[model samples]
Target: MVPRNRSVRRTKAALQSALVDLLLEQKNLQSVTVQAICDRANISRSTFYLHFENKDEVLSSYLLQMIGRVHDALRAWTGSDDTRWTVYFAHIAHIAPILGSLSLDGGPHAILSRYERQFAVIMQDLVMPGRVPTNDTAVGYAAHYLSGGLLALTWWWVEEDRCGTPAQEMSRRYHALCSGQLCP
Candidate 1:
């Protein structure tokens, strides 16, 4: 359940912030410890446990919140359809730092897969009634294909100096790489 009380929200934010700080300092997630997170956040271990199972949980929650924001941007964008990628990548600036630290292993890949899944849903939701897929199977395949391409683009952007090129360039690359897909 999402926390409603402001105090609960504050505690969760502190824990996440502490984890980010630790990741920044350590250069690796495995080196960070729960006790360290508790100390950094100045929250009790019991309180931490109430909100998270482990350090990874804290990271996941933080990533999800970021992803949720991106999803909202994609949903709320009012510009041309071709610029959807820009809308999405624009929010990624907030997440690139975390992905950079986690990119050493498959951590970034895990998050990218989540992005694919979430993007597929967002695409389906945004589809016009007139453009509905002929069948559920077709939609599923297209979602996988398009979101996979998007994932690849995002991975490249993150690894390439956390968007060495701007989000507009990334979106341009996406539209150039593949266009006219019903999913697009």
Candidate 2:
């Protein structure tokens, strides 16, 4: 059973790596095929189907792993001394190519939705600790708005060549906006 679990993990890792490589090489993710991924991973078609329903599933899985890392970073953050935001932005910059492919594929609505839900829960737990909003609707709206705005900003940052804008600067601007500052 342990060997089987290990094999599954290895296969999934190979598939994830292949997908990332393929995404980096291709302009459009829609054009990538299961067969191509299998070939790149040196796995058979049957093996791919055993783990993933399709290429989109593989992409979704990969994104969930990335989001999990971000969540872990957020959880580790402590007070004003934390540089989690900068670290998050640096991670995003590192994965910009993979994100660019997802953006090219009409953007990742599912992944964004997942992030929105996670962010909402995190906000409720951290930002509003020991207090519950009387109006759940308002809280929901605010959460959605903040999450969407953050996602949009991240998308813009990844798409544009900001001429060597450091992750720390970008994160500072994000914090400024979050703090209701109109001008960064």
Candidate 3:
């Protein structure tokens, strides 16, 4: 759990930012080390340890915060599917830069088979028609499949500059799928 003290928050944020900057620079997790993060963040080992156990903890904490942001976005919109999805698309689009940068330098796959299972919990809580079972059920398969496709498409949409307005374009595509117009 994160401490409520302001100083602790700053320390943790520093560690998280340092990890990201290192990951972006090195392009892989294996290349990142606690010492590198400490050096980049400008925090000493004692200060870093006061907040996190290791570099992976920092990375996981950062990822969890990101996922929390997505959930917060989901909570902020409650309307028609198109409207909700448009808002969500806009939110995720703002996060595209990070995803686009995560090509990972030819290792530690980009949300392919690697992140699919882990991302399913978040996806299942999202716009599926019903509660998606987490086990090896058919519904679970469909949910993971959809999430993987969505993740891949988000990375592509941003990396390739598919459209100037991602929210609108992605929302249009969503409605088309809902209407059985896959080509649209």
Q: What is the C-alpha lDDT of each candidate?
A: 0.77, 0.77, 0.68
Candidates ranked by lDDT, best first? 1, 2, 3
Number of the top-ranking candidate, with lDDT as the measure: 1
Q: Write candidate 2's Cα lDDT for 71-103 as tens digits.
A: 678667774622446766887888887887787
Cα lDDT of candidate 1 equals 0.77
**Better candidate number, 1 or 3, judged by lDDT:** 1
Which candidate number has the best TM-score?
2
Clashing pairs in 2: none
Q: lDDT score, residue 71, model 3?
A: 63
Model 3 alpha-carbon miss at residue 184, Å: 3.5
Clashing residue pairs in candidate 1 (N, C-alpha, C atoms within 3 angstroms): none
Worst 10 residues of 3 by lDDT: 104-113
Give the CA lDDT, 0 to 100, for residue 24 in model 1: 80
Ranking by TM-score: 2, 1, 3
Off by over 4 Å in 3: 1-8, 21-36, 49-57, 111-114, 129-136
Give the Cα error of residue 144 in candidate 1, in Å.
1.7
lDDT of 2: 0.77
Q: How many pairs of residues collide in each model?
A: 0, 0, 0
